[model samples]
Target: MRGGSGHSGRLLGEFRRTPLLVPLSEGDDGGLMTGWQGGVRWIYAFTDEGALARFAQSRGAGAGTGAREWEYLSILGARLVDAVIPTVDGPTGVAVDVADEDASMLFPPVVGIVADAYAVDAGADRADAV
Candidate 1:
């Protein structure tokens, strides 16, 4: 248990420090968001690992072909992720786009993208609390 917790921490830290461009692809998780304004396919340039960890966990990758449990990152450099959006009504997750960017450096082979979305409640429910 201790090792698992420590690893997550390490991963979280690594994600935050690396200036990597994570390409997010809407997976089959079935996000709840609806009627968004922009493209769902987004290129989130995050310097925060904690957010990245959250994104990785949300997909429920289920330990792919590897020693790592809950493996999300594929050797191909692109992983599938759920697309969640905050609308006027509430938070919803689905397949979407973010309009292609000229971020050639952020593309595959150079950088890796763990496709996933915001797992936690993106709605008012989380704020309401237990």
Candidate 2:
């Protein structure tokens, strides 16, 4: 458990420092490409263009065309977790490097990963008060 906790801290710090590639929605008014899983809204971010391309391919973005271009915004992980996540309603989290099984990381909508006000498990600390 200690090692796992250390790993989480290291990973979270690394994620906060790295610049993530966030894909934009295809519309005149571009919005973020997000999804819901287990009631949590996830904002997908890739570590690099290769990672993004792999994800896009897996999702069949272009299908038979074999040539699909995706629009993206490069934002630091800190801003995503600190600024963007708060603006979004409900529990929101960032999913990083989703295409790579070994490299993937999930910044879940928990007390440590998000603002206390937005964290799904914000009250967990209080549970220990008893």
Candidate 3:
């Protein structure tokens, strides 16, 4: 959701309330596995175990020598957007159910989806005016 629309607001609300499974990278820190696209970094969140499984499989996790279960962190969408996204460097956002094309949702780093300080487009108007 790009933000600033009723439908996008509702979708963001629902996403905030949902429980998401976020994959963790293997290491001491076990940080979140992020993706970069459209000049924005994305934190992936799955609706359920099945969704996560699909994503892992697509990444070749269970194929050939790469077969292994993914480690994950269970978190609410709100915490991801409100707390986590802010800590990341540069522009970041949440990607929900990404493996499922029809069910996917993207909460981009815009005014409403992120804090004003972190939003890439937050000061766009002022910049243009300058």
lDDT of 3: 0.86
Pairs of residues at least 3 apart in sequence or in different chains that clash in candidate 3: none
lDDT tens string, model 1, 1-130? 1333345445433433444334334557533222333422233433334444544455454335652332222111112222212221232222212122221112211111222233232222445444
lDDT of each candidate versus the true structure: 0.31, 0.85, 0.86
lDDT of 2 by residue, 1-130 (tens): 1335556677788888999999997778687888799999999999999999888988887556566689999999999999999988888999887888877778899877888899998876576645
Q: Compared with the true structure, what per-residue lDDT tens digits does model 3 show for residues 17-102?
A: 98899999767877998899999999989999999998998887775674777889999998998899889999999988888887
Locate the minimum summed-lDDT window of 10 residues in model 3: 1-10
lDDT of 2: 0.85
| Residue 64 local lDDT, model 1 | 58
Instruction: Rate residue 129 of model 2 by lDDT.
Output: 45
Cand. 1 TM to true fold? 0.22
Candidate order by lDDT, decreasing, is 3, 2, 1
Give the winner by TM-score: 1 or 2.
2
Residue 91 displacement (Å), model 2 = 0.7
